[model samples]
Target chain A: AAGVIQSPRHLIKEKRETATLKCYPIPRHDTVYWYQQGPGQDPQFLISFYEKMQSDKGSIPDRFSAQQFSDYHSELNMSSLELGDSALYFCASSLFGAGGPYMYQETQYFGPGTRLLVL
Target chain B: EDQVTQSPEALRLQEGESSSLNCSYTVSGLRGLFWYRQDPGKGPEFLFTLYSAGEEKEKERLKATLTKKESFLHITAPKPEDSATYLCAVADTGRRALTFGSGTRLQVQP
Candidate 1:
């Protein structure tokens, strides 16, 4: 089975620079979620999109923004990157149900993740 | 606010030892509870999802059970290959994203 694909598995950037991370979700999965995991910490929810629309937001920084394209792929753009931003970024995809009690069964599958090192 | 808490910050077991990891959560309107295994420097691998209390799911040497306030992942006759950080997360009715616990780091020595 094809899993979610992430671009630039490893990235290095300097302070104040800009970076863009791309994620291609699994086929037929309509929802994409982004998370950041700092060293020795658990993954934190950043944002999520459902059917190309922003469905939810979490602790994402103001300097960071994300969007899902028409093809169901998503991108996370960060500006004025700080050293504290260094972490592993992960993208997860899930097939969302139309709407009903069964929507609770949506299971998310994750990608390999991108390691960001801000220098 | 939704909160997920995993116990035993770290656990060490010998090959073939059996143990269980706990994840306690507090959320309004629980949507689902999930278990994932993550290797060093890699994304989390999905393990199981329990949608309601009394639900149970299993895969290989792992079994997950959920109740109203907590979930448990039991590993039986584990091998070193099963060593990894096990994360527990939950989704609420208000959001599509998951709120994760810090995770339990399991080290199985062969």
Candidate 2:
């Protein structure tokens, strides 16, 4: 009940097809973050959601968009997937307050990640 | 430009060997430094968070120490289960974004 949950653990999509990944943040955690890790590389920041709005976007393409619902569920949509987009996508959540009334310390709790393969 | 750099892109050690990994940074004001361990196909597992210089934290066989400009993760008598990519990240004072390093891959063989 206090961890990040991502849907569709693995997905394979044809090139140029649309793919969507979903995430459910921990209760009372207002911040949701997403990262993409390619093979043999570190995770790169994709975007973040705070207060039910898109707060930041990294160097990702316009084709990649995310939305946060009122219930703190976030969805990442990729329109027209490309081979380069194939990677493991991770979702994380964190609370904004200063101290440890929150769960899992101040560190973000990451989901198991969604493996997306755009062939 | 905020940046984080990890050294010794890769390392191999026999079981029971000890080693240290380095993470250097260049930022205006450092709010936090984080260390994470990641397996081949999994998300990073948070290990430590250093907020100031001369601060240190330990868990099991790993100890993390921090300085003004860099941080070090020392592994004591590592085992095969310690084999993973260790990533370091920096969160500046003003922003919530985290700048991450390329990471150091450790392979502990039996």
Isolated chain A TM-score, each model: 0.95, 0.90
Candidate 1 Cα misplacement greater than 4 A, ranges: A98-105
Q: Please write out the lDDT profile of model 2 over residues A1-119, one tens digit for every residue.
A: 56788988999999999998999988888889899988877888889888988877786789999989999889999998999999999998887754233321256668889999988
Please state the error at residue B3 of candidate 2 in Å. Answer: 1.0
**C-alpha lDDT values of all predictions:** 0.94, 0.87
> Which stretches of model 2 miss by more than 4 angstroms?
A98-106
Residue A21's lDDT within candidate 1 is 99
Model 1 Cα RMSD, Å?
1.3
| DockQ score for model 1 | 0.84
> Which structure among the candidates has the greatest DockQ?
1
Model 1, span B51-110: residue lDDT tens: 889999999999999999999999999999999999999988778889999999999999
- The residue-level lDDT of candidate 1 at B7 comes to 92
Clashes of 2: 0
Tens-digit lDDT track of model 1 for A1-119: 99999998999999999999999999999999999999999999999999999999899999999999999999999999999999999999998872237658488999999999999
Task: Show the lowest summed lDDT stretch of 10 residues, model 1 chain B.
Answer: B90-99
Q: Which candidate leads in lDDT?
A: 1
Candidate 1 matches the true fold with a TM-score of: 0.97
